[model samples]
Target: MLTKNRAASFWNGVRMRTLAASPDPDEPPRMVTVPADWDQDAGAAFAAMAPGTGRASLADASMLWVGPLADHPQASHGLATRLLDLLLRRAAAPLPAVWHGLRGSAPGFVLNLAAFAQPEGGLEIDDFVQACETLAEAMHLLQPSGQTPCSLLLSNLDACLAALGLDYDSDPARAVAACLCALATTAMHPHSVPSRPGASAGSVPPASPVPGLTRFALARWQEAALRGRRSGRSPTHELLPETGPIETGLTAPGHALASWTDALLGVEACGAAPLFSPLRPDGRLAASTLARLAARGMSPEAALAASLAGNPVVAIAGPAATETMHRAITPFLDRAPEAPTEVQAPMRAAAGGGRRELPARRSGFTQKATVGGHAIYLRTGEYEDGRLGELSIAPARGSPVQRGLLEAVSQAVSLGLQHGVPLESYVETFAYARLGPGGAVEGDEAVGSATSTLDYVFRTLAHAYLGRSLPDQPQNAVPAEEPDDALLPLDLPRETHRPSGPRRRHGLRLVG
Candidate 1:
């Protein structure tokens, strides 16, 4: 058993078992290398399929990427190459089937291919311009009708064209700009009646007078004199030579002067975009033009507010909530503006003949009293644990008018809540009522009275039970009083006595 040959055989068997039980330590891991030329080839293929680009080269490259030749070391290499091929093919052919395929695939590859198709520094000016045009055309063809996809492609195209210093006069940039403007116009004026059935196909106006394809465009055109000023270049004459002559309708002499004044003021407020911003420095509208629109009764603040409030689902509940909120609060300035302040209640009683109920709770202890030109309503009731409740509303503590207004507001809120209206909807309705035409009088009197009553009830309950302190009432405290004539009568259930425990003694005497 101890022989050298026998021992060597035994060691060999142990080694074999160990090797089978665990992974090999001696063997190196298999190495893989992805071809660096893959991205370049894919990019070339995509470029070829672009409009004004070589379609044949694109097709050939796409076939090579997707075929057996694409069996590269990197697993993603084949997929990436194939996607580029498909993108180029789609750009060239643009069939509905290809569009469906694109919708299902990763957007990253398509975006990358678009980026690659843009002109690089190494490309000659003519070649670069041609590539830019082709890329623009492809992007225009692929632009989605739905908002999300359209926004993505629109943003990409804007960036690419801007980098190349392409203007709206250029084929692709102009085409793409037209599409974006259509989207913006649709968003702004969805209910706009079409001029004619088929004539409205490509008739979307830009958001503002400026073709703000990007944030930079907005910045560039925000100011008055600086709007068309780009590196001392006159944008109107150089970039947008097609801009038609400004047409002014006949107006009264006084109105025209006022309009000019308004325009001058607007030009002073906003400024131009910074140099660092990414946008094409062209297509800005003049401040004077915007002023004219304002003179025609176009309130920017009101328009923005309407836009914010119109979309019940998305702008309110979705990603645009914050933006909507900003729009809703935007302010406007008008000549001879009145000072902003809360409404004051008049001393005269409302027109109603009937002796209205006092805007106070029906709690058994307090009373309504008038003091210092204001009404003060006191209330008392039982709290959650049978504790005493007390509360008071002294409208005259600040201003008699303000007190009355507050009382009315409180009443309206309570009545609306009691009627099962949602809090938000009720608030919006109330705000509208106060601000809308022929609504002020109704809100101040009738609506206010109802809300005041509700406020009294809620305050009485809240003070009696919900407040922090829970001290017992004094023994000699004033006795409970009867409810006011205006208040609705409450019917309380009668208390009955009950045994606390079983009467064992009645059945049998227990001996301990």
Candidate 2:
């Protein structure tokens, strides 16, 4: 039972319907009172429910009678106070705040702020408490600032921060606040929310967990978010969790697979975070693992991807471990286990008198883009005149199969381009190729998903050097415009003239 903390006199507009513990079909039901204590027996026996403890306890828990704040967002302070009060109560225990939407054993309100997603490795109650505390810290950091994105705490973790449409030095406090508002009354478990007619919102498995929201919280969050958008301040795009449960594996918060990276690859880029796996449900990693990796070196984005999926030699030894390790990158591995060797498959048909050599003093550049939820590492070789000549696209290291194919295409394309093949000629050769768990076009919306990331990066390089823009997309679907400064380019060797020669048979290898 939630008794108002009357000692503090302020506008705490949380009006929850008293719990009516009535199972009898005849007698009128009474309400659970504030300041009332529910011992174990009372908690068990007196209850009216549509189902078990999961659904029944929460069914009549929170029938909010929101006032004008329900329609106004700038009035978020009032709303936030109300919601926070609920969390404070739930965190007190005895009467938990979030009861897993009745989907789990104990029924809880849609507002699950008291509940939190599990982190990498596993979870404990302390983790949930810390997450709420962090949420509180973030909520307080939401003021518009000109100095720094003080609230963008996880900017260095590209996979997690980027998915939320934020980066390091980009304020994500507003977005997190929006997510909290949205998740206030929604179930984290998809199975808990009613899906079919006459069916409970969350009656079975397969429910898509709504991050940071239950049904009611989502409604309040949406209302507040809309008003914020109209006022020309915080927009929905800035507040919501862009990646849903499936995209980020948030449905299973406690589980994530680990892969190992050499840590030496791209030392400059990989040296920021030791463990770069995607964020588990509550945006947490194994603290011990993070400390281990950080002490060693930065894990490059590729290694980050590998850490999530491909097994480190030391970590993988059994099927259970393999499953645990593979869980993170299941979506990225699209190659058939026993597919024919790609490098040799094209050798004969592609070797029509291979080019005598690759360009001397060619410029090499490495840039990374994330597709799906994984990072796609792209390295390019360009001619003296800044014309793109060759490219390599790959997932994280340790996946020999993917790396081999990427190497082949890069070498083949390098040879062909050196032999005078126009870069644009291969545009359609491998454009729109798709494989792996994530082919989502991350940096540039124009380059959508590619037939192969090798193709995607090469195409992207062509546009960058040629001063061309990608084909326009619908206004609504257009992504956050990438700023020029975001691209890091390297000019290898001395400048010279662009190469030209007759296209060679090796160009066949450049073809899809």
> All candidates: CA RMSD in angstroms?
27.2, 25.1
lDDT of 1 by residue, 242-269 (tens): 2111110111111212212111111111
Candidate 1: where are CA atoms >4 Å away?
1-65, 68-155, 166-176, 179-512
Q: Best TM-score goes to which candidate?
A: 2
Native RMSD of candidate 2 (Å): 25.1
The TM-scores, one per candidate, come to 0.17, 0.25
Off by over 4 Å in 2: 1-360, 437-439, 444-455, 472-512
Q: Candidate 2 lDDT, tens digit per residue, 148-229?
A: 2111111112222222322222224223322332232122211222122222321211111234323434444345434554
Of candidate 2, the 10-residue stretch with the lowest lDDT total is: 253-262
